[model samples]
Target: MGALMSVAPEPGWPEPEWHRPPVGGYTADDLDRLPNLPPHTELIDGSLILVSPQTAFHMRAMRLLENRLLEAAPPELDVAREMTVTLGPRDRPEPDVLVVKGEAEPRQTTFQPEDVILAIEVVSAESEARDRNVKPRKYAEAGIRHFWRVEEDKGLPVVYVFELEPATKTYVVSGIYHEQLKVPVPFPIKIDLTAINRRQP
Candidate 1:
């Protein structure tokens, strides 16, 4: 007698009868199983999205910003990289950089925008749209008080600082830093736009 072959079920488990191709989505589990991703990819809207690769100048500016921010960071502040923030099932995004007030381990949940003191995104050609539109709304909806978009491609970061406007339920631009401007954060640090410009690729 011939052995019976077992057939695998279709991709979508619960609704096997519902015929539809998986419309590309990822769960937190999917993100966990991925092997190390290159720095240029970020997880957004439950899928891995490719961002523009950083250039030498971009890296230099990032390093400078990191150094300045780190030096003046409050003891309560925790600076991190490519960390995921759960913004509903369709809106989880891994920001390039974040400043938060508490440890991540014990919490186990991704950073809530309210938990984050600030969010900074370094925009390259590929990431310009999301950095400008999607992320700002995601952070704002999550109640993040401040956000910064750093445009490295322009040879200088056009910093956009947004603060939540309670009455309006939206973030209002508090400051825009093009050249030399002091950030309104409690701890003071000078972001040298000239230095950022000098390092542009």
Candidate 2:
């Protein structure tokens, strides 16, 4: 009988190297192990973030703000709060308030910069830095139409309003409102910031 010949397998296949996966990619197990998160915590860019819980004062301010805008907004316009804004696959934020120029939906929906006419962040002692630096830059990069930062330290609803000018990759701080009532909002409608500022938190 002729000797049986064994064919060897091809030799050019890539070798498998066992390396730890990048931290940027988190598995379900990793997510599950995350500490118990407060209501304000949100996942952004695959990192866990702890946001300050909205105080009663904050809620009051937000509601009053929304109501005023609603009154001046076109029947088709929509205003929302604490809703998720997804900037990219890795970035999702829930701003204190968001104003949209479109038909009203029955419920709040996740939004993108394109869906937002304005994004508002309320700054408490803790969140001031993130709101000023992290969010503003992200909103600018995402091409948000406008952004507002309301600081609690001010006597009234002291806010900084910025309009996105993509040509410069930065926001044009169009106006600063010390007295809520005195601010001239550029949108085709008016909102009562004073009313919002008075809400009991």
Task: Tell me the number of clashing residue pairs for each predicted model.
Answer: 0, 2
Model 1 lDDT per residue over 72-173, tens place: 788888777667776666555767677888667863636766778878777656556787887888788878777777775356666777777776657788
Instruction: Give me the runs in candidate 2 sitting further than 4 Å from their true place.
Output: 1-22, 25-40, 101-109, 181-186, 189-192, 197-201
* Candidate 1 lDDT: 0.64
Location of the lowest summed lDDT over 10 successive residues in candidate 2: 1-10
Give a tens-digit lDDT track for model 2, residues 149-173: 8775443466788988979768888
* Candidate number with greatest lDDT: 1
Q: Model 1, 130: alpha-carbon shift in Å?
A: 0.6
Quick one: best TM-score, which candidate? 1
lDDT of 2: 0.63
> For each candidate, what TM-score against the reference?
0.73, 0.72
